[model samples]
Target: MDRIDTSVAHPARRYNYWLGGKDNFAADRASADAIAAAWPSAPVAARENRRFLGRAVRFLAAEAGVRQFLDIGTGLPTAGNTHEVAQAIAPSARVVYVDNDPMVMVHARALLTSAPEGATAYLEADLRDPGHILAHPDLRATLDLTRPVGLMLVAVLHFVHGEGAALPIVRQLLDALPPGSYLVASNATKDFLPPQIAAVYDRMLTAGQTDIWPRTRSEFGALFDGLDLVEPGVVAAHEWRPDEPDPSLTPADVSVYAAAGRVP
Candidate 1:
């Protein structure tokens, strides 16, 4: 709790604000408002990304027969969290959430509840250090590394700046999992945004309040290299097996790319 810095805007908190959550501070709201002004569809894109998460988790648990999940960069707990979605399909499913935010850690209890047959755990770890997450006692105890696990990196990878930093971390995490494990990821992209809107976003990023690097479609797809992508391939978040396809949502409206891939 003491580690939480309410003075500056944080990614998770800003995301929460975008999602209409009440857990964020004034700094987060201000940043979110600024971004929304630049991109009117920002809030809608956030909701669509969350819906994509639910669909992916359901597919992994019900169709792929996966029983374990490791969700990194998990933001503040919301309505249909990974555990809830997975356990709804298989009550015995186990999920481990990873996030480095102290505020998220403060609200970890909300994410810890699990069905009697299933298990859930939260780890205070950063995405940059895969070793610490893999070796964490709580993660080891909650999930069986030998079995298939769902590695979820939804709406989180854009934070790691630099040209080649994000992919290696992704590969390292994927390598640690067994052959049958899966990788589910969604990242923000500038491919669909108009030049003026993209420039506004870039200007916000340049302020250094929080780092965000929106990738191109090809760059986002490269994160799933060597893994078999699920049907429909990589698409905009709202377009990925949507439960209820919104006629209004277009590529330009949803600026995030999402996909699920299997290790084998």
Candidate 2:
């Protein structure tokens, strides 16, 4: 595996730090701490994002009867990955995780293990190149585009800059999948955060790690134009149908949004 740079804080590493993992370097810890200081609920929001992933995966696997998943921009593996949650419900679920980050690719095999009945593979590709992902050997080997597949965009779409062009890329990926498929996602948002928090995050993005272009509820909803939104609509990650009534899991004030949609 290639040595990861510790000089600059990365979004994945900072998120790992927020989740109380030891995979982050000093730079990541420092940046996470600074953000946490400004937005005290930042760590909670991170945890909520993870929880939302778990909820969305389980819902798709159990309720929606989805067994194939294509998770794009999968960050550092934590507890309850897509395959882990999905396979727990249906042991035959197949998952293909895609990410351009070298560290994420390395960790995908090392940490995101699959159940014996199910299969998990990783694709070293970027979200900007949907064709590359579709043509990836690992993806083609694992996922069948003719079947109902779960397209997971998680917390990575915020890295896409400009008029949120990632939406069209998402459309291309979804266009290939069969009917009854789903798009599970969560992107960062500044609509609810304080000005200082947004300012610091903007600086962090300008530093060259990742970009965060937060949108309003309607703007976020625009990504799923042709898809049917699941219950509760686009809302905070914590507000997306909690399994248990979590009082501490109130709507996050941090700049993060999450939702899941199904293809009709």
- Whole-model lDDT values for every prediction: 0.89, 0.83
Q: Top model by TM-score, which number?
A: 1
**Across residues 145-189, which tens digit of lDDT does each residue of candidate 1 receive?**
999999999988988887667899999999899998999998888
The reply for model 2, stretches above 4 Å from the true place, is 195-210, 252-254
Q: Lowest lDDT 10-mer window, candidate 1?
A: 204-213
- Write the residue-wise lDDT of candidate 2 on 36-151 in tens digits: 77567778778888989999998999899999999988888888988989999999999999887778888888888888998999988888899999988888889888989999
Per-prediction backbone clash count:
0, 1
TM-score of each: 0.96, 0.91
After superposition on all C-alphas, the RMSD of every candidate to the true structure, in Å, is 1.2, 2.1
Provide the lowest-lDDT 10-residue window in model 2: 247-256
